[model samples]
Target: MKILVCISKVPDTTAKIAFKDNNTSYDTNGVQFIINPYDEWYALVRALEIKESQGGSVTVINVGGAENDPTIRKALAIGADDAVRVNTLASDALNTAQNIADYAKKEGFDMVFCGKETIDYNGSQVGGMIAALMDMPYISYASKMNIVESKATIERDIQGGKEVLEVEVPFVLSAAKGMAEARIPNMRGIMAARTKPLNVIEPSNTDYMTEIVGYELPPAKGECRFVDAENPEELIELLRNEAKII
Candidate 1:
């Protein structure tokens, strides 16, 4: 099983977020970056688990600039055999997915894994886009996957229950929680990662279907409203009319 796992670099969850240039760009100053947790904890770790059990190599791929190299290296330390960095700064989902598909197309990987969404953007767009561009089957929010020979059994959470599926090789899946437990790099693994191969390549396409207009922060918290507990009708009305939950 030759597996390809997509990696993403994102700000630490505890980092302070701010916008710059009149709220058009994200501020990087004083920000700490890390491997997107969904990618690291679930997708990448699951891929490594497969490799350990099935006897094949795992390759980690990312589409970003030099700053992302360290993030990719962390994946290597976790247990990937090699890494590929598409040396491009693509904030657009279409372009980023396109870049990954362009490389995976040439690599002939049997399985492609991705986190359900990045922590920063939470777009949940790239995995599906890559599957579409590659003309491959896509399974989103997969929480469990088992491989035997050339067949794969997968499970995903749906509205009320879990959905199970069977697929062959050469498919894409977005990993969710419960895929695998997170693994921290040991000292030996960390030392080996320094010498592991990390190939950098340029993107095949640079054009993007969309671009960011600008970013605006959400509105500040509104004042609290009190509803008379004596009247359930009033509480229902407040929830429906004000909170809009129903």
Candidate 2:
């Protein structure tokens, strides 16, 4: 079972987000980057678990430039046997997915896994796109998966409950919470990752459907409005007029 786990580089959750170039680009200066939380904690870990049980390999893939190498190294440290960096500047979801799908198709991986969405972009499209590109079965928001023989049993989160799906090998799945527990890299793992194979590959020609014109932070919060607990009239008026709760 060769599992290809797609990881993403994202700003650390605590990083302060700001825009530059008249809000045309993110101001990465003074910001810390990390492996996307969902990818690191759920998707990659789940793939590692599957590999441990089935005795195979887990490879991490990312679409980014040199700036993302550190986070890619981190993923390798966590348990991925190797890493592949699609050398590109594209941050668009579609283009990224296309590049990954192209690589997966040629590599002939048995399973491809990705997080439900990257924390930074919050675009839940890659897994489905890859499945579409490969014309393979797709299971999004999968919280659990088990492989038996040549088939896979996947449990996905649906609107109100969960859905279990059985699909053949060579499929794509987007992992969400409950897939697996997060693992911090140990000293041996970290040291070994420094020398692990990190292949850099150029993305095949793929037309980008969109480009980011700019980025803007959400508006700052307004001054807090106090509610009078002893005065019922004030509370009602505030809710109806100011807060618009009614």
Candidate 3:
């Protein structure tokens, strides 16, 4: 099985987010980046597990500038056979998916995987877009999968309960939580990753279909107010009129 896992670089959750150019873009200065948690913990690790059990090669692909190489290296250390970095900073989800889909098509990978969403944007659109561009079956939020002889049975969450579905070899999946456990890179893996193949390729398409208007942080928490515990009706009024919960 030839598998391709899509990875992304995201600002560390603890990093203080700020906007630049009048709040039109993210300010990356002094921000530490890491492989998106969903990508690393579920998508990439599950891909590695599949490869280990099925005796196939796993390749991780990223769409970003040269600065993304460090995150790509981290993916390699987690047990990917090789990595591909599309040398382009994608402005939107479409172009990012387009670049990845183009590469997956050229490589003819049997399976394509991605995290359900990126922490920074949380769009949860790239995987579906890639599946569309490649014209393959797409399964999102895949939690568990069992593969045998070019067929796979995948489990995912539905509206109220879990849903299990089956797909053939050539398909796309966006991994969610419970797909797999996260793996830490040991000294040996880190050393091997330094020599692992990090293939850099130019993006096939650079046209962006979307633009960022602006970004703003969520409103800060308001001051806490107290109501007399002995007066239940007053609390009800507060909830109904002030907090609006009722």
Candidate 1 local Cα displacement, residue 80, angstroms = 0.9
Q: What is the TM-score of each candidate against the true structure?
A: 0.90, 0.94, 0.94
- Candidate 3 accuracy as lDDT: 0.93
Write model 2 residue lDDT over 1-246, tens digit each, in one string: 999999989999999888888988889999999998888999999899988888989999999899889899999899899999999975677888899999988988999999999888899988899899999989999999899978999999999999998999999899999999989999999999999999999999467888888776778899887766787689788889877998
**Every candidate's lDDT:** 0.92, 0.90, 0.93
Q: Listing every candidate in turn, what is its Cα RMSD in Å to the true structure after a full C-alpha superposition?
A: 2.7, 1.6, 1.7
Model 2 has an lDDT value of 0.90
Better candidate by TM-score, 1 or 3: 3
Alpha-carbon deviation at 140 in model 1, angstroms:
0.5
Alpha-carbon runs more than 4 Å astray in model 1: 222-246
Q: Which parts of model 3 have CA positions greater than 4 angstroms off? A: 227-237
Which pairs of residues have clashing backbones in candidate 2? 24-214
Tens-digit per-residue lDDT, 1-77, candidate 3: 89999999999989999999999999999999999999999999998898899898999999988999998999989
The RMSD (Cα, Å) of candidate 1 is: 2.7
Clashes of 2: 1
